[model samples]
Target: MQKTPKKDKEVINVIIQEYQKNDLPWYIGYSGGKDSSSMLKLVFNALKRIEYFHKPITVLYCDTGVENPIVTTYVYETFEKLKKECKQLNIPLLFTILKPKLEDRFFVKVIGRGYPTPTNIFRWCTDKLRINPVKELIDKDVKAVILLGVRSSESEQRDRTISKHKTDNEYYLKQSGSSSNIIFSPIINHALEDVWLTLRYNELPKSIDFNQIRMIYKDAESECPVYRESKGSSCGNSRFGCWTCTVVRKDKSMGNMIENGYSELKELFEFRNWIAEFRDNIKYRCSYRRNGAKGLGPITLEGRKIILDKLLKTEQLSGLNLIPQEEINRIYELWEIDEINVNYQEKRLTTTCIKHG
Candidate 1:
């Protein structure tokens, strides 16, 4: 390991002190990205240095079920290694993976219910796939502190939001119709270069491959897939998001990753592009919203069936189970119900017309 800088040491020391002082359980958001990786390293190091502190520290990972295959594998392997190491060190560390409910799954919403592909304005994926799952866990814990890897230097709007919600050692996150939770961003002030340097110099767990992470960074530019809009930038342009994301005009991250030698992902990339094309065509989308408004809504039933067939073909080509069997079953059930309802409505309309005539 390289020598740690004075500022880095000071920041680590502050983190240690805060962890020691807080009695509340700590939940670190691990998105399997660079910033989250750095934050976890700092916290883990701090805990290692402590003698007998006993407040539980849990790392929470929200698996959207649509993450890049490479990232998902890396994160799971790293977590398993961290669990083993923490056990050997007698460190009170726990890792939990949170997943969205079946009803809220990507395919269930898109293909099952004929929902349109997510767009910049109608980005319904984030809340259902990412935030709500994690938030559900956070809400269960009373007075818990959630640690995030967000950095102020990442964007101007982020800096302002961080500053606005700044507290003594954490930020306040207001949950909808629920009590607020505290969020601590230890690396909020750190620049991008500082983050990379820390990851390079710090003695991270053996499970973490800094070099692999560096490669991913080189390819993707940014980590988290969920889009966050900033001044002159957006997550779609720079960050790693679901391969099937249609919000961005282009999925540069996945394209770069393929260019960098992950050729197996080509099928997935092509499928994502096809989804975007399908969503853009007016013939595939419904002319009215779910509430009967004259606006864009879910895809038409025929469009949904076509999408499912194509998706299944993509899965076969990619050699990966893109959608879970349970989700597929649920989608089929929904389609049956939709068909039944349509038939019943048509019969009822015919009967009423005969009576009136």
Candidate 2:
């Protein structure tokens, strides 16, 4: 282990002070990435220093179902280890895996509803998949504090956002879209190196394996912002998101992982590329909107069927259960409903023509 820097110590002290300041339950947004991991490490150290636990500290991990399988497995395993270790250490930390509602799942919207995969303009994924689940849980509390791994130095837009939401205290910021919740970033002042130092040097919580996380980083890149607090906030080339994500022209992150020895990603990568190209093909799209407007709409029923077949084939080839059986049942139900609607419309049109003639 490397030497503990004075700056990391200062951050941990600050965390301890803030944690003791209120009885409010704390929610830490964890993406299982380096930044969040480091922030969590600091939190662990702070908790260790205190004699009494004032309130609950819940670590929230959002599993969108579409997350990279490799990362998903890592996070799940880590959670198991964390639960056991925290129990042994007598740390009153709670670990929760939050998930989007079934209807809001990625495959449900895309394959079941025939909606296209998310793009820059129609990035309907972020709120439904990542943000809403967390918000739903947090809002259940009358008021709470949310700790995030956000740093101003990550981007200019982020810097501006931090500046805009600046509270009297430098460590806290106004939580966007909610008056009941406040945002606290313990590592607000930490640079990239500082983040790594926090993770590597912290000895508590014996659950986290920094080297394993580092190995993942060596293959794939950084996380996409888990929560979109602001309207114009970017996703930051998110690697941990849905394997089927097509928000970017190409998923370079997955590609890098594949090249770096995660060969299992090849089929998923091919499928993602195929879906992106297939999405824009007019033949596969409805000529009219779902509301009967004369404009381009969702993928046609035939297109949806083709995509599902391809997805199943990919799942079989990759040996990964990409879609749940529940989702498949829902998709079939939706297809039946859509077909009934189409037949009803055709019959009505035929009757009108006969009457006019």
Taking the tens digit of each residue's C-alpha lDDT, what string does model 1 give over 218-284? 7555655221212223344445867788878888888888998998789999999999888877776
lDDT of 2 by residue, 39-130 (tens): 88889878878899878699999999888898899999999998898888778789999999999999889888888998988888888888
Q: What TM-score against the true fold does each predicted structure earn? A: 0.90, 0.93
Candidate 2's C-alpha lDDT?
0.82
Give residue 311's lDDT in candidate 2 (0 to 100): 95
- Candidate 1: the clashing residue pairs are 225-240, 225-241
Worst 10 residues of 2 by lDDT: 348-357
Top model number, lDDT? 2
